[model samples]
Target: MAINEKSPSPAPAIVESEPATRCGSNTPGLAATSSNNGEKPIAHASLEERAGALAVPPPSGTTSSRYRWLVHVQFFACCWAMVVAGWNDGSTGPLLPRIQEVYGVNYTIVSLVWVFACVGFLTGAIANMFLEPRFGFGKTIFIGACFQFVGYAIESAALPFPAFVLGYAINGVGMALQDAQANGYVSNLPNSSTKMSFLHAAYGLGALASPLAATQFAQLPHWSFHFLISFGVALLDAIILAAVFRFKTHDECLAAIGQVRHLDEPSEKNDDSGSETEKSHFRKVMTLKETHLMAVFILVYVGVEVTVGGWTVTYVINERNGGPSSGYISTGFFGGLTLGRMGLIWANNKIGERKALVIYAALAIGLELVVWLVHSLVGDAIAVSFVGFFLGPMYPIAMNVCGRIIPPSLLTGSIGWIAGLGQAGSALFPFITGAISNKAGIESLQPIVVAMMAFTIGLWICVPRDKVRTASPSSSSPEGAGAIPPPPRPVVNV
Candidate 1:
């Protein structure tokens, strides 16, 4: 396979002497420019040019110190946003009983919150496809935050049941945008596997802490008080995003992280082509077999994760005859999830993402069985936590695989679809559980989770294997000055 001879022109008018590949290597073409020492030969170069010069393993050293600092700050903001998302998702489990009591609703009625949220998730996912290209990552995230703020505000008011469910819908839209962008952004960074783990670990931390707060808040007359805390956090998240991103466009954000490559050349001939191009990319993403498999995989995975977190409190209280502190079981689950993400980085690497997920799924199935069969409250609680622990790493690992296999051009939209649709499971399965529990006992939760886990293993097996790329040590390092080696032709087995 031969590399393309023509490098795509940058947004600006500057021309490159040598054609470069997506992996940041110069292919054999024309004479090399003498100014290849991470310095621009042309003054007033485009942001794409600057990014090209800095290259892929992510620029480090004195020259990019400020850019590095900005990346760090931006990551912090992303993590904070994830925490808020986790808090929102995790809060519902502990508050479910209280919400039912206040509204005088049954299991099926209370589950409407998640159903409405699922609708919001689908809406947000579709909106993201159009929004990011037009509004840029910064504004897109801020818009999501604003939507979340509105949702939290509505929920905190403790409105009618119908209105309360509407809030979850709005909140779902906000979370979909942030989740897609944050996961896509981190996966492109250096040491992505490690960073992606930590980024999601922050989400786990938020999920862990929220139950503790929500359980206490459930004791109050106004159970909606828990959302007030989320309202404040959402406000803070919006502010941080606005300040850090400064409303920069998508290309500008890519330039900041040294990932600008193969961006669509801005056409003076047809200004409207940008939207058309986005549509084309989206169409291509839809046609790919990998995209569908991944979407279903994530959908099932998230469904199981959220179902456990959201319904565990009700399960404990009703089945185990537990006290008011039953919410702690939810906290224990997310705590194990957070610990697994942070602690299992080495294990993931040791076992590989594809094989490791199967093992994790199997372990989670066994744990779910323990939670179902065991009558002891303490024993069920411990099993639930371990179930969360094994299930924790699956999401990040899936995201990492998607980043590797998907083309850079389609990455953002593909991820938006994957994350957004995947989140539907978060609502879809939970809603199903509740509706079913309305007829069957809440003990049905374990069987549904176990079935999803088994189905997830099948989905994982169907996903395409990542293309193998070999990088020289110098190119792999942040500080090494050697030219990056050209990537070999992609070889797809089966």
Candidate 2:
């Protein structure tokens, strides 16, 4: 519970100083600097006494307001990747029937694409733990974009069902990799919750547009043309992402994002024992109860969102007897989602994230009940859209909480799994809904979603009541492997 404070000003070379605790490298405490400039501080050591000298501070100069504005632009570019994710996510529900007919498979088989995609997401999420440490944030996202390109290209080829599943699976991997990076990047910044809300709002906008565009594209002779649109968007997303987060390493990437700045740090830099250090951090963070809780939280939350969106069209057309015109109701759902994120972002600040989630979720549950019970097409559509609206801010808010509790040393890995495998819910729950629908009928989607929502609430309540941790300068940077941790809590699991 004690904190060590070091003066910012350089100190004379010392033989000894007060000892610091062991295994608290990432905890925010003053790091005493020995005057020796050459040697770096010893990491992962117990009883820190005059640990090696930190690099001398370079000449300090203010970043121009103009430069700050330019950096803000990069934030928008990052949102584009989210938009692409939303587009791909939104398109799936509308395209399921078409894919089923074209592949000559049952709903159960066609839905397997979701499972494959979840597999890809889980793999990509794990891969990012190593990727970000070595390649830095920018390049990790680039690798993800590349996966999207590969996935879309393969799907666009109109190959057999297996190949099509493979393409979408790749796309899922790409989405999780980029997702983890972006959320980790943004979550640590100032006003992160508000910014995260807008960032996710871009996804809403993309999702809102997808069903309309995809439905039109599906009407074409080649239904696969929908993937082509996704492909083009991914290409643009990759270019923008590279330009925005283009750092040679995570250190530079952090500086670029205004997390840490070095007056004298050179353009090129090397991380000390980065590979081994990354592995160590990964294992260290895996021990946290919060990490696992948040992951399950994401799984349930995303599962509910994707299930409702992904199955809405099918449910409307087949179950409600609403016909093709009813397909556009997915747009209404996404529209409410878009509006909720945009409208409630600042409102969440007023009411607090936890309170807001509770209220919105209750309202969403109520509306979902309406959708389930009310057989009227117009009433169900209205209820469903409201359901989406209330669900909109849950993800960004939950992620903001994760950003608060997770240690900086393990931010990438923890967020990766939470964002990555959590997305598995998208595939997993939808697949479940489809399987159940095959037997119980598509009407099962409403009950399935309601049940999932109930489960989500339980898992959500299990997330540690997050208190925002103050980030010290060293801790703010992704390269701050030795930054201090947030407030410690007794280990408790849901």
Candidate 3:
């Protein structure tokens, strides 16, 4: 593989100096001058050439102190959306019995709500596969909020079960799109793994808030009121999201995060050279093998996480004799999850993301075993909370790892595919649980949870440990100069 380097200082306009490889010249490396300024001459490269450069590992000790604050802000923006979605989605578990009582349906039929939501997610994930490139991250999120608002609005009307399902399905579509794109965008930035932990913590916040929210909403006498409140929140989120869209960046999002010194390009004596150079530099991302592996891992992991959250409420209600108030059990679980993410911020700072994931996975399986053995409601509550705590970092950590393992160019699509796979799993498992509970007995749910956790443990073994290398701006640059490494490998699936 060969790399084409261009000088930072502008050169005199000329017919040609030397012919660069057909596709090899387009990439503006980390050292390349601002694309906005004509000071740095741009070069074009073929996809293969760009991929080759992307494949080169970053040197260790590279950090993004400059962009740290901006990363956190963007992360929080994504987190706010997750919190809203989690509140809407996780609340279903606690509200199921009420819905069943009001609608006069069986438990199996009631669980179908999750099926509708999962199906919608699947649709959104698939849609994101194409939409992400066209809309960019900001617009994709706003669109997702719109879908969620519509879904919530539809559900608020208290229509028949079929109508409810349709509405939930619509919401899922928006969530799936926002999730894939937001996650893809997040995975590409510096310190992404840590940022991911912080970002997912917001989901825990929403999840924790949900049962409480439902408990309060239940006091309102009409479920429609609950949906109305949710609708208002979703509308607000959409507005905030749309305003956030104005920050999109080219070349790198570095400017958005305040990492760059200037936005304006040096006044170029005009030529079509730079624009042509950048367009050619755009590269194809995923190889067939990488794509397949990503799909498998994500499918398995999401099934485990969602299944646990979705069923924990049911298990408490059916097996432990918990009432609507027992919905607090779900809160305990998300409480653990929230705490775990906070703890991970400290843990990751000490040992880095890879080691943190290894520890989190082993502990999660152990907690699941506790849930398996303990038959009492108290025991179930403890086990579920522990499960939440341990599983907290998996999604973000896995995403961080994926970003590192794959080239940046393929990031948006790769993240979308992984998210889609997870949504597919989500769609499959809740439906399976509904069907299984109808026949094998609700107790079978315990074994299903155990099995999913075990499968995740096994999958962890196949994931290659991330290797860190020290990166230099260039051979001539002295040590200690600032440099940002590529994204880390994904450790846990969503």
Candidate 4:
């Protein structure tokens, strides 16, 4: 096999000097370009193009059977770790009231946990650029494990308010690191939509279990003891990852999974080649229209999910006059979320991704409004659960769509930022809601959620469609690489 960049007219790389656009004008679903005669469907043309592109491929050796076993190990172990992270995510909101009671703090002060967690996650996401390039995948994940273990150890010690918040921040960084890596890695696999859905479902499953356990454990004299369970699980996950992936490096792992073909490895003497490769990837990733649109969409989606999870119990008990027994309703919301991710994988695929997203977003918005407008606690609880159910499939679906649109060369870094910074929703929106509640009342979660849902629908409309255009007659049998798709169109419907 041979490798060469010989497309007749390649799309120019986005220059570093230009800022990336915030949205694109392409149609809602797949990006497409009609055939010259306008007789063929864009999807069909895209598959043909992909086929031709695959025909003149770069050299790559087949993975041995050992690689297969390790791949399974890596996948299951990463999933185990994600489950622990999910447990942390779900338990927090339920335990927040207890923490506030223990520390004698108000809503505004208690919200700092989300803020600190946000900071930690963002820090870790940015740190990936330096960490993966130097330490590679296995060692880098090991570092994250250390951070989680140490952070959990601190939290389990039952420290002061500030100290406990600090522990959360540290653990946030660790979890973000792992989360970003796992999502990116999963997106490149062959059955990505299914895999991503299942991966996140595991997260949801763990999330479902967390609130149930936390509500039980949080009642006694020690609220923080609930975290000890999470700590033990995290420790076990760390050991699994370390044992399975000890020697694998960044390039090694991607190659093992077939994502390494898009970017070539530079020879030892040409250090500049590596730098140039990185720059080119950075250019495509930042410049892609889908990258920005998906980022903002996720920002809103995550904020909606975490905000509801984090503040629902507070809202139910305080604003709706529900009791501690009702606080466990947060798990119902999370249970819907888990089931949605698990159950909706087929529906999402059946309808195109864009339509599926729009449908779910609309459903979530309406249900959330019911939770807001209605005064009954039981009614609100049911609405919140349904809202979570609709909102469940959003994250993994968004990530899967993103992987399809962005060039393969930029997958890891591009996804790293998307998963990391997009997660700021986990902090920013919730913090804003908490602050507003401090002033106006906890009733504010309703409008914030409604507005976010509206924003989500509009943003999905602006996402670039995935399609392929026909080549001119002269280049009918292209010599080398397939042509790159055109740059993202202008913002259309948004």
Candidate 5:
């Protein structure tokens, strides 16, 4: 946290000084600066240094390298949540027959339970919009674990269908909270998207583990025991979260970096006379364009990504000739997801985030097509796993883009809303897959997957490059304005 200031020059006439209120700014919204304006430019380099400060820089050690132990602890907690929640979702298909015989519930009644999680997800996503801002990501995670643990406990005890549904609802709330908070927290970290891939892969790892656990437990007299295991995992997460309360994640570091960067910049004393005018413009522009568009982008991104992950496995097994063991094919899908995530860590470190995403997207669509065209189970499984590799980076990259676009003042709410909407998309598409598969046959799932990928690439084209890079006057100075920026290189820690 060091700020080195150079001599300050006279403030140049306003060239394109877009004034944005700080995130959580009590001040009115930001005014937009048109690049077309003819004002004299400020010192480009100095302004950029200042703007970068305004950005929450990636945390130095609170979440990386030397703080390895803390990272391990948080990763474990995150993995635990993912596994249990995913297991609840994944295991149900296999456990359905057993569950029906034991409870005497009809198929339609049982289907209601599957959809219940989405209801919970929607509720939780909305709840997080309020909680994340007030409590911060870590605290929100702790609270989520509590809800998940208790909710699972209730379900594990074998309550009535209504009670079971209630428990699932509660757990869905917990899932949404953790998913949004944890994903946001990780993406904000320096080189976090890669870590994000790993963290999510851990969930897949957990899901992979679940089938074996469920199969073993299937021998037991009661399915309640399987749920008890989920409860135990959630409880363990709570404990781990408590132990790591003192540690900071990527968000903390970014916040600190932003503060330092902002502090070193020259003050607004020179423009105080015109501050009111600038502020007025800022408000109008924010309302008219940036805010709303950013929201839409976020909502769409999340929905698409989740829909892919949630349904890909089912598509592989049900349509492509995966077999009775096909339910286990979801594991292959998740396994590819895990490997893809691991690979992203390196890719993010070597290439820049934008390029990484673009490349991954290309790979994803190609692999998806491979799965779609090839009816052989072997080819389908291979393609599905590869799809994970490409799909690995999308969620985190979209989040990082959101962080860059939305100012910090409304970051938590904006991020939460985007995430919630995305999950809502996640829920929508998966539910559609289930419904469609019921009537059209599972093989029809390929077209939807392909369509979603095409849609994602189209949206990605709309992402403004300014959102990805620093917005200092120098970066956007007239001379440099239209130049295509070079690819970003990964920053290395010494």
Candidate 6:
């Protein structure tokens, strides 16, 4: 007998007032009665009732309304930490002359501070990969703050040359940890682009203000006293971090915020499996071509930024033949950088990040050229400020892109590596410039900056575009097949 070919009838839909499985217990026959049969349909259980039924806890990404205030406080603390980092970085440029005079060293020797800082940054990046998983975000950030406090304390006393360099290494570790965590946290939040811009703008504010303080200190006998100010800020950062975080682990913090992952069904895996998963994730992050491309792009970008900020005063004094007021050029550069980050959010959104960055780089290169070719001190200073303005938004924009491209699972580690390694450019390129300047004169600073800016444009082109997946109409339903839900966008109006 020939059988007719037909698809099987679809299964009847069942409406459950409460889940059949709760806390490993099976409680069947909870489906709502049919209203067509003259029976009342059952109401759905509330979230509290559902939680009580399921004894298992939710994952870190779940949202809890009660702990939302902590998120805002933590964000402010992160901004304050960035300010401290900027102060440390910005002070170096103005204080370079005084440091050289105090230690009786050349440009090459003075540049060792950058080298040591680079070492510290790399070390911190590596350490964060290991430390964050074990100690969690709160402790890691707090430890980093403590390291900065130590570094600043040592530097404030103006110790022997080797000890002074060691302070920078310590500071590097602190900054790297805080930088990685803060960026990772902010990038995941709602309106991340705007938030990232504001965060970096805080850094620019510190950078802008530092030169003003450092210039005056450079003329004083106790020039090293400038670090005392940094030391105080670092201490404040540590206290705020400790109090706000309450030494909570990463998972604990997530749970407190009701942002638990796998809210309905908890995983039964042990620590060993978790470690293995992390290892695999790390392997995946390292192998991706985007990670390396971003690392290099950031390295070159930071190199150009720090090189200009750190060397501009010296260049103005020696190359442009300016006097005590030359240090103000550094202030102008950071001021422009701050303004760009604050004011250019609209432009960044209008033109798109990739194209906007290309434009910004081109403009920056033209400004660098003007600074190089124009002999007028006033014109060079103004051009340098504009250069800062163009370069200012690049860091945050690149960071936002990095967040989008990289998997959320591997975000913290990947950012740690990228940010840590990228910061190396701040040290490596400046040191290279200083070593070269020892023989070639500070005039070479312009060529070096222009070359790096050109190179940044090329590297940025190689970065992968972020993948944007549109949800189908069916996928919008909770029960849709092959549906992947987007994360909640919780606005922290701080």
lDDT of each: 0.76, 0.72, 0.62, 0.69, 0.56, 0.74
* TM-score against truth, every candidate: 0.83, 0.83, 0.76, 0.78, 0.67, 0.81
After superposition, candidate 2 runs with Cα above 4 Å error: 1-62, 261-274, 467-494
Question: Between candidates 1 and 3, which one is better according to TM-score?
Answer: 1
Cα lDDT tens digits, model 6, 1-494, are: 12122222332211111111211100111111112455322223344343333332222222333345555666687788888878887888999988988999999999999999999988888787767765667888899999999999989999999999999999999888988877766664435679899999988988999999999999998998999988888999999988877887554444343333222111212254467644654575577666778889988898898999999899998987899778889999999999999899899999999999999999999999999999999999999999999999999999989876654445667787888887788889999999999999999999989999999999998898885211111233432322222222222222
Q: Write the per-residue lDDT of candidate 4 for residues 1-494, one digit (tens) a residue.
A: 22234333344322111111111101111122233555543333454552333232222323334344555666787777678777888888888888888889887888898888889888887776445545556777778777887788889878998999899889978887788777766664445678888888888888888998888776878777777888888888788878877646644454443332321222111244455644544555567666667778887788888899889988898888987766578789888998999899889879977899899999998898888888898899999889889999988888877766655435566676777776677887888898899898898888887998899898888878753322211234332123434333221110
Please say which candidate is ahead in lDDT: 1 or 3: 1
Candidate 5 local Cα displacement, residue 358, angstroms = 4.5
Q: Across residues 10-61, which tens digit of lDDT does each residue of candidate 2 receive? A: 2322111122221112221223222245544344232332332222222122
RMSD of each: 8.8, 8.2, 10.0, 11.1, 9.7, 10.6
lDDT of model 5 at position 152 = 85
Candidate 1: residue 463 lDDT (0-100): 88
Top-lDDT structure, candidate number = 1
Tell me which of candidates 5 and 6 scores higher on TM-score. 6
Once fitted onto the true fold, the runs of candidate 3 whose alpha carbons sit more than 4 angstroms away are 1-72, 218-220, 247-254, 258-287, 348-358, 467-494
> lDDT tens string, model 1, 1-494?
22233333322222121122222211111111116567643222454453444332322344255555666887888898899888888899999899999999999999999999999999998888778766767788889999999999999999998999999999999999988778766765545678889999999999999999999999999789889999998999999989988776554554554433332222111236577856754576677666678999999999999999999889999999999999999999999999999999899999887888899999999989999998999999999999999999999999889877665545667788899998898999999999999999898888888888999998898888785221111134332222222322212111
lDDT of 3: 0.62
TM-score of 1: 0.83
Model 2: lDDT to the true structure: 0.72
What lDDT score is found at residue 65 in candidate 6? Answer: 31
Runs in model 6 lying further than 4 Å from the true structure = 1-69, 254-278, 468-494
Tens-digit lDDT string for candidate 5 (173-259)? 887787766665554443454566666667666656665666455447887788888888888877876666533322342332231
